[model samples]
Target: MPKSSLVAALSALALTGCSHADDGGPAAIAARAPLQWRSMATPHDRDRLRDWRKAWKTALPRARAFAPERTAAEGALFNADLALPGATPPIGEYRCRTFKLGAAGPAMLDFIAYPWFRCRVTDEGEALGFYKVSGSQRPVGLILRDSPTRAVFLGTLVLGDEQAALQYGADPNRDMAGFIKRVGDRRWRLALPYPHYESLLDVIELVPADSARETP
Candidate 1:
């Protein structure tokens, strides 16, 4: 599948709602994540990623052990962008950023009013999808990162933000449990935190495509 299609397929399996907003601006923040900003993963990051892989392998036997959802819309509200039948909201575009090279100070948890790392909160036909828009020059992998549940959608938004944050160890912290939320019309947020890398949580705010501003 095409890269964008891959993102859609993976997220659709778990996604399902929100407000209407204008189309967000172009990916102006994309420039910040220039090629020079990229870097290799740290040693600790490699170890943790290995662990995550091991865990996934261990869980493979039970990947299909859970019962199907009782209703099509049971977990449809994984986020506001998820379409709840007729009440679904439009997906928004986000600008992403990461703190890979080094933080100006100790990592702080604060609202990023500017575009650093952004992802699109996709509204699938009956599901929703999301993925990176900038940063790492890699095709991000999407996986359900939370405990098994029929009504929840959780995954990492990696290789993208900074289009780099903790960049948290490895790929979007497949273990960094997080989800989507509606903040306003044509606006949403994906509150994903890197597993164990608390200082680098991703509260990616999304603005509607219509809200996209011309690059200055």
Candidate 2:
């Protein structure tokens, strides 16, 4: 069966509403995760999702080694433990950029930052949709509320020539999970760790396009 079909089938059996219990590991934390994410992430990815700090610890120092000045200049963009309240970003266009840290392979750069691109956040009833509309590699996913300080990001990447994104569980290699948090009044970030790609940690900084110039 297709992953999307399987997800739909299984979702029928999983608890449909929020569960206040925080025990019994990732599967038990239904209230904090989207339906697709809870069903799709591997045990290891779930651990990565819950304890994302490990990825930060592993990546930040390596990035700093390569570009201390640049890394330092990023400030909260590079801070792993700086999530603030009001994790959801308002629906609208945003100026976003990718900052990769800790190369996964010897041939890749330890730290690399990309220029700003366009992204959007949409209200999807059960969750908010986040899509990077500009870039060779784009991320499109649902942002489900996790806590007052953060939200769970469950989505997949859209590579060149792809007209539409794959279902979150369709391809484990393309699957992306992370935390979205508000770092400042109008600044938000999606922090993905130990991605199935070149970087150990990928931070996507987002700010309202209209107010990008005022970001501090």
Candidate 3:
């Protein structure tokens, strides 16, 4: 799909946390754990929390980046092309945004808003529900699913909103489940998910929350 349209679709999808699935079982579970929270403390028995701001800032350039620079018409056409079969909601447009991480380079972030639909059957031979991304294909998203559910903000590893983080210490969308403690300006440490402390660094490249705002 055209880059422009992808952004719009993503934005819409982000606004609405929908998914395309034949079974509502997952959805039910997700709803139950919609938003959970935890805390990160030092001297964990297994995991060691290290600051990743420097490494993330260093890898910015290598990461691909994109920004919004087209008209709504262009975005519309792009979305149409991406709206393929099995595509939920059929995303139509999006706004591209970019976040620069010093020497690391720039990371592309899109704001999309759309619908989700899915179809599935239950064990009792009952037709399950249908879920799909509102404006695009299935709702393939990266969410932090700790005891609670925390939606990861698009193009950023940080929680989509403060409420998500405050409610659920770290983001559940990420592979590693742990607490995120800010050490410096835009810098944070992964306080959980033993053996994968470095993996958190990878997410930092995807979402540069450090630069979003200045920390005391």
C-alpha lDDT of all candidate models, in order: 0.34, 0.77, 0.24
Candidate 2 shows a clash count of 0
Residue 209 error, candidate 1, Å: 2.5
Candidate 3 ranges beyond 4 A from true positions? 1-24, 35-52, 60-94, 99-151, 154-216
lDDT for each residue of candidate 3 in 121-163, tens digit (9 for 90 to 100): 1111111111111222221222222311111222112222222
> Top TM-score: which candidate number?
2
Put down candidate 1 lDDT per residue, 23-123, tens digits, no spaces. Answer: 33112222223211012223443344435334333322222132123111222212323422222234556554331111113553222223345555464
The best-first sequence of candidates by TM-score reads 2, 1, 3
Which of 1 and 2 is the better model by TM-score?
A: 2
lDDT of 1: 0.34
Question: What range of 10 consecutive residues in model 2 has the weakest lDDT sum?
Answer: 1-10
As a TM-score, model 1 comes out at 0.37
Task: Please write out the lDDT profile of model 2 over residues 1-216, one tens digit for every residue.
Answer: 222332332233344343544454333343345655555455655877976888899899999999999999888878777889999998999999998999999999999999889999886544677889889999887777778898878777899878777755557898788999998879998999888899999999999988735333
List runs of model 1 lying over 4 Å from the truth: 1-118, 123-126, 137-153, 160-173, 193-200, 212-216
Report the C-alpha displacement of residue 125, candidate 1, in angstroms.
5.3
**How well does candidate 3 score on lDDT at residue 76?**
24
Clashing residue pairs in all predictions, respectively, total 36, 0, 58
lDDT of 1 at 95: 53
Show pairs that collide, candidate 2. none
